[model samples]
Target chain A: MRATEMTPNDKTNDSTEQKIFDAAHELFVQKGLDGAKMQEIADRAGINKALLHYYYRTKDKLYEMVAKSIIHQGIPIIQKTIESDLPLEEKIIKFVDFYIDLIRRNPFIPLFIISEMNKHPEQFIEKILPARLPRPEIFLKQVEDAVAAGTIRPVNPQHLLLNIISLCVFPFVARPIMQMVLGMQKTEADQFLKQRKTEVTEFIFAALRPR
Target chain B: MRATEMTPNDKTNDSTEQKIFDAAHELFVQKGLDGAKMQEIADRAGINKALLHYYYRTKDKLYEMVAKSIIHQGIPIIQKTIESDLPLEEKIIKFVDFYIDLIRRNPFIPLFIISEMNKHPEQFIEKILPARLPRPEIFLKQVEDAVAAGTIRPVNPQHLLLNIISLCVFPFVARPIMQMVLGMQKTEADQFLKQRKTEVTEFIFAALRPR
Candidate 1:
């Protein structure tokens, strides 16, 4: 939200600002904050250096915008899905579906974040995530209620959430290693992920089904 | 094995080779292959540059040795553990236990591998992993047997293995983000991992248990 939220208040200003942002996002994800140059971002955006600077004054500012943009686009969807009023099974399917789709679309986000976090831990830990991050409590309560109603076996919601996240995220993060180990090419890897939408949902459902 | 494999016949030669290797390992991990320097490694090992070169010949050779050493140390342990004659539940537990412990002790390995693999995919995919990487067939067959015996519900073993691995590995790979989300300090993160050894194994068992 903060990503799109930081907009100038005019129609042309918004489009130019967005172009600058789009260019920054590509470069930052590919080359990282330290490796990316402001001049390169300007050229990529088809804007002059003065105009790019006018929009986002510093490289760090642009990098922060890109990070916030990515996290905003990705994490909130899961939080909103998890917090929705759908039944537990449907809610979880949606979560896995959206989370996997997001990762598939933005495969670079994880490595970029990990690399940047190592470079700027205090910024990520102290500033960005803490600002508007969603809590897992809503999903936790849902799990607890499901168990209380005997719709599912009693389980720790934290562990379950962590499991769901791990399943969805790890394949993307460890793709190279997993690809080598599984003997999957890129097309095969995509097919595997397609199957995972249902595979992961059912896997969790089977685990949670009462004895 | 490969990390310390390229050694001369003499004991003194072996120790010096190992010392050079130990120094190379630390530097390559911290600075990566491109960033690491032979002189720094020599300095770190308390050996002369001539000796380091005599052992490794070049940084690439040293990097290959380090990567092999790490993969050799880290991965085969899991493969050997899974292939042992333990029952399904116990085998899964051993996996989660050994895996989480391995990542905990060698926190840099995942990030380093991912980064290095990105840098040198041809080497890793074409050369390294193919040499002795474990197949998931044993685990897959074990799951099939469990299902046929009515000890567990029918499941795709590949998906199951991927889920199990994702649960175990993602926490370490995405620690910074997870740590911020969970609001955990270093000690709490360690405590959380300790709990996951049990939590993940049981979570999987609960899913696998026959209806």
Candidate 2:
């Protein structure tokens, strides 16, 4: 049972390097950066320690690769969705859909992020920044337009952004507890969470719409 | 210095264990659980490893003490806050206040919870249920009441509750990057987070209030 063997396509010249990343990500999530070991990563990748270093030079460098991969995977969607020409409510729906899907694709993304961010937060956030989408001025404008038309109450765009994220992200981050407390089974939890895209935007708009 | 020395009024045979917990809490935050060492904990507590093992048995056991202590500190507040006769809005306000103060007092609390929770989630959740608040049904009913009375837009109460939590918790868990992104120093971050209690409650109430 080779743990680290990869298909030829996955290797390229970077195959060894890629193996190191795959191992690092798994170990990082399971045990955190400090708990993860270069030796273990080497072993997991089916390579010797020298070969592991030959690819990535250092543990920190390899970790940065994984971290960047995560941020790149998650952040661009938000930037594009919110900055799109979609309608206000539709933008929200798309935003929620984006995160819910992202979490499903990467369930550990939040825990991985929250844990590592807490460790060397300066490093994590800095890594995340260059990838940050341009301000969703369109989303903000949509929100203002809704408020002006007396469709929603006046609310800060930043706080509104916070609201959208909280509903979408929190459940996935707290899934184990949420599932237990809310009496949901695995499939049930997935379905209910998927249903949240519609539930959340309507709820927020309902709350904000002026009389 | 005599390791395991007791205070003049100390009588509990658990003093050594208590010292270990206090020391572990500080070190876990300072160096993380993995980074922290048994010897370091011993040095800080002024106790020997033999006594530590005598009380807790292993490093995991010692960590359990810290996790349990943090859980004990917060869980009752959730129960009492939810089970109380306070009005919904007031309850919301108080919960925000409680969480903010608690997180502030131990800035590392959320990170610690997320970390250990990720490490052994089944064990953690089995030990302390996040939904142990008796009669969460009451909060649910209140949300339904507001929705039915048209005092607020229709919302899944659970989603709204989740929203409030994410807004409050995420920034702290993501403190390192958030500070960099917002260009805030530690004191500035403190003030920014401090203001969130009022901001989060009002934001929810505003968004949820009847259109």
User: Model 2, residue A169: what's the lDDT?
Assistant: 72
Off by over 4 Å in 2: A1-20, A38-51, A82-91, A122-152, B1-19, B29-32, B43-56, B85-87, B126-135, B145-151
Give interface RMSD (Å), model 1: 2.2
lDDT values for all models: 0.79, 0.72
Please give, for residues A1-211, the per-residue lDDT of candidate 2 as tens digits: 2233334445554566676778878887777778888889889988899876666666777777777777777777877887789888777777877877888788878777777766676776566446554465677788888888877677766557656666677777777666665667999888888777777767666656665
Estimate, for each residue in B1-211, the C-alpha lDDT of model 2 and write its tens digit.
2222334455354676677778888887666668788898989989887767776677876776677767788778777887786887888888788877777777777777767667777767776444453456778888888788887667778777766777777767667655554456999778777777777787767767664
Q: What digit string (tens of lDDT, one per residue) describes model 1 on residues B1-211? A: 2233445455474588878888999887765665578999999999899887777777777888888778788877888887777888888988889898998899878787886686567877665553777777778899999889998888888788888988888777777777767777889887887788788887888888777
Q: Candidate 1 DockQ score?
A: 0.49
| Superposition-based RMSD of candidate 2 using all C-alpha atoms, in angstroms | 5.0
Clashing pairs in 1: A207-B207
Superposition TM-score, candidate 1 onto the true structure: 0.80
Candidate 1: segments with Cα more than 4 A from true spot: A1-24, A34-59, A85-87, A126-130, B1-24, B27-61, B84-87, B126-130
| Clashing pairs in model 2, backbone N/Cα/C closer than 3 A | A11-A15, A207-B207, A207-B208, A208-B207, A209-B211, A210-B211, A211-B211
